[model samples]
Target: MSDLPPNHHADLRHSGPSGYISGLTMIVGRGNDARLVADLADLQPGDHVLDIGCGPGTAVRNAARAGIRVTGIDPSEPMLREARLLTRLRRPAGEVEWAQAGVEDLPLPDASVRVCWSLASVHHWPDLEAGLTEVRRVMTAGGVFLALERRSPVGATGTASHGWTADQAAAFAHMLTEHGFVSTDVSNHDMGRRKVVVVTGRT
Candidate 1:
């Protein structure tokens, strides 16, 4: 058995019409995480970014607005539809595309992306190892990968327990290092009504 920590919400698959509602609600209170991810990426104008589990394309569009090529992929059709509609209506300049995919399977060429990020989504991955291997495969030499989760209180329950505690963040950082990522780090930040932990590493 793998020694990795459990994915807190492995069975949570946001799909179907209810996913639309999730997407709409997702638009709220996520700007901080999205903007923070984009900032942490240190993106160049023409760089390519892949956002795994990119619900509603919030982070995708945030990166795209900086004149970069960005693809937002999610497993849910309804979420992708909502993302597409939102993108078309509030179009940000630069290349923006949406794909229906999950973390375990990415539809991009090998070593084709400079940055890969998952915001508030990694915990939902059914298989973290496969997801990380796929991420490492698609990233170019010297690429960056980041995963951000809300910093939840220990022993919390229900919706409040959806995020990671400090220990969980550290565990994720260690896993990142084990996956051949260099300079892995974990940090805590206060993002306005939500405290979050971010794990970053360079490949």
Candidate 2:
């Protein structure tokens, strides 16, 4: 059996319209992960950024605070609702756009984003290849894709149902390379029980 924790959004029937809120709150309550993305993306003000699988707009709000034009996309309308609610809480500093969509079929123009990041949401993708392909298509040349995916064998259990295997990372790197991304770095970073691989690609 898979060792990953149950997805909070597994049942949307009773999840209400703010399912994204629960998921986002669970994934990123404060701004810790946003700081991680900031450090990885080295973002500057006015940069157009995309936060794929952006739960509750944590990264979106954080990026917006830095004067970055942030757009968040997710498949859950409930999540988007929470993101909208979260956006309402921002102090009208920067701009934030929200889209109810997924990485594989994003509602964004091609080669239009400066930074694209996904935190702790890669494993839920039904088609990682298609999702990454869409990511590549929407990123401008030299744009950054910081995908922090959970890796297997993170804890004493020696198995992670929620995390991807080492081979999976290599395959993702290869796919990114095939899609015209260069300088791909795929390695695991220990995050307590989760080993996240920060994949950066230059297109």
Q: Which candidate is the best by TM-score?
A: 1
Give the per-residue Cα lDDT of candidate 1 at 35: 91
- The alpha-carbon RMSD values of the candidates against the true structure, listed in the order shown, are 2.2, 4.4
Model 2 residue runs over 4 Å out of place are 1-21, 24-30, 154-160, 191-195
Model 2 worst lDDT window (10 residues)? 5-14
- Deviation (Å) of 119 in candidate 2: 1.0
- Model 2: per-residue Cα lDDT over 1-203, one tens digit each: 33333231222321464574466555443366677777888897667999988877788888888777988988877777777886786654778898888778989899999899987677666666688789988999878988776666423242244555566566666767887788788766665554566667777
Q: Tell me which residue pairs clash in candidate 1.
A: none
User: How many pairs in model 1 have backbone atoms within 3 A of each other, for residues 3 or more apart or on separate chains, i.e. clashes?
Assistant: 0
State model 2's lDDT. Answer: 0.71
